[model samples]
Target: MAQRELVCPEEMAHLVERFNYAPAVKVGQMVYAAGQVGRDSEMNVIDSSLEDHITAAWENVGKVLAAAGCGYEDIVEMTTFHVDLQEQLPTFLAVKDKFIPRQDVPPAWTAIGITELTFPGQLVEIKVIACVPDAA
Candidate 1:
């Protein structure tokens, strides 16, 4: 049997220094990523618009996937949380199209309206699961 590998980003290393949570956990070929928000590399919120935030969050997801040696195409599932689902749906799909084109196999996704998030201004949160070829 092989040991599962845990992956964390340099930014997440700073997070682990201040908090406690593994960014992603890999067991065999599957990777589970934590909810990612719209914060920039410095951990500062970058955009207030729904479109901007959604784009930023997905970009962050891409970063995490890259850190784990994966990509959007490798993702099999995604779950998104939003404060205003009806109002944000259009923007979300628009931003999503920029990343995951219709020609590609879009990951199975779910969007839920939430009452609140950890941050006051955060309008969106996203979590994803991905898989890669087994190393062993």
Candidate 2:
């Protein structure tokens, strides 16, 4: 089996100390990130407006990708879980576009609307898969 390198940001040290999951992992040129929610450094999921939660989640994803030596443009796949998909998609996309402005060939995407999430009031979670060119 190929070895996978765990990707954890120093900012999320508290989560690592408590949980068994890495925020993401890198194998060869690919990086797979766990779903990022609007959680604080201490793992407190924020209960805020959808826009705020979405913005925070994307920022967290950015942090993880950066730690894994990847960038937004390198992302090739993304999955989003939402509490109210129908009502919030427009707003979510508006906020997401702010971060991913260039969509010439946007990553493959999947968005799921569910009745609830792990946290009662948490509204959004995002996971990503990205790739970098193999080293020379």
Candidate 3:
């Protein structure tokens, strides 16, 4: 079995310390990132607007991926949790497309609707699984 490595970027150190959970974990070439919300560098939830929140969440996800030695293009599977499914899905999709602009072969995605999230005003949370290339 491959050893598990916790992936926590410096900006997100507060989360790991406060919540006692790793933002992402890397085992071999697979990086499993936890749900990333629209939080700032100080871990404050960004809720100015749906689009802004969604974009921030994606950026947070990107940070976690980078810490795991991965990138958005390396993501093989993605799962999003939305507070307001019908009302916010279209906006979320638009923001998501910007981060993952590969129209040819995009990663597998699943969008889920939820009532609420960990923090107030946090509309969406994104989680992903990336497969990084083996550095020989």
Candidate 4:
């Protein structure tokens, strides 16, 4: 049986100490990360241009991935929730290309369009699942 372990990196300790939730959970070779939005290190939402908004979200996601000892290449799946998908896709995809690995077969991705998110002035949120060899 694979044992479940809380995978919280010191960089994201606020998630556990303040938010009362692990930024990500690790079980054996798999890791499930929480959705990451384009907020500051202190979690304050940022009001910025479309590219910057998308960039920040991916940066947060990268922090979560680092916490799990994984890289973008280790990501097997990703899901994103957007407040304005149609309007943001081009900029979002452009920014995504900068983060996601250019693998022969890329990770599975699903994007959802929605009206709003948990916070005001937020634009995008992304979460990912990574599968690594001997990750535990």
Candidate 5:
């Protein structure tokens, strides 16, 4: 069997601690992306607002997917964790709309409220699963 290829964005190393889980892993045609927070390239919190954080988190997910040669359309599932789901749902949906157009198929999604995240002031985290194109 051929070895699978793994991929990640350069920003991921700065965003996640070295001792923590890797940003993304590919096995066969599936890519599993680690939970992404609202941190910038330096791992510093970007915005204090829940809406800002949610948008940043999703953007980070997109970066990782792009590195893996995938896109939002290739995502099959997503799991989101927020400190306050009720307060952030509308904002999350609004940001989601920017990425997933009405004509595109939306991926399976789940949202859960959490007490906290790995870093202080972090408001949202997102995990994604994407399918890679078959090798010709």
Candidate 6:
């Protein structure tokens, strides 16, 4: 069995301490991230605009990816859970494009709709699988 390396950004250390889960885990060259919600550093849900929530979630994903030595382009698969699938999708797509613009070959994606999430106001949660770059 391959060894696992945990990835957790300093700013998100509270999550490890409180939740007891690494934001992401790396094994071999693959990095798998936990679902990232639109919560601030203090873990309070960002109860702002729809766009803000989506953007914040993506930002959290970015942080996790960075900690794992990966980037948005390194993501090979993405899975999103949304509270309001039809109502929030248009706004989510708009925000998503900012993080990951349309490319010749985009990452595999799946969007799931659910009734609720960990937090009350969190509308979206994003998780991803990425490949770490080969060492030079």
> For this target, which candidate reaches the highest lDDT against the unseen true structure?
6
Stretches off by above 4 angstroms in model 1 are 103-105, 133-136
User: Deviation in angstroms for 17 in model 2?
Assistant: 2.6
TM-score pick, better of 3 and 5? 3
Instruction: List where candidate 2 sits over 4 angstroms from the true fold.
Output: 133-136
How does candidate 1 score on lDDT? 0.83
TM-score for each candidate, following the candidate numbering: 0.88, 0.92, 0.94, 0.92, 0.86, 0.96
Model 3 regions more than 4 Å off:
none
As for model 1, its CA RMSD to the true structure in angstroms is 2.3
Ten consecutive residues with minimal summed lDDT in candidate 1?
A: 97-106
- Model 6 spans with C-alpha error above 4 angstroms: none
In the order shown, the candidates' Cα RMSDs to the true structure are 2.3, 1.6, 1.4, 1.9, 2.4, 0.9
What would the per-residue lDDT of candidate 3 be over residues 1-136, giving only the tens digit for each residue? 7799999999888878799999999998999999999989886888788899999999999999988887888999999898989999889889988998675777898989999999788888899999997787
**How many Å off is the CA of 122 in candidate 3?**
0.7
Model 5 lDDT per residue over 1-136, tens place: 7666657687666434675566888887788998988878777897767777877888888998888888878889889898888888899899888876564577889999999998889988989999977657
Error of 3 at 69 (Å): 1.2
Preferred candidate (lDDT higher): 2 or 3: 3
Candidate 2 — worst ten consecutive residues by lDDT sum? Answer: 40-49
Error of 6 at 112 (Å): 0.4
The CA-based lDDT of model 2 is what? Answer: 0.86
lDDT of 4 by residue, 1-136 (tens): 7788787767678768877897888898799988889888877787768788789889888888887888788889999999989999999999999999799989899999999998898999998999765634
Positional deviation of residue 73's Cα in model 6 after best superposition, in angstroms? 0.7
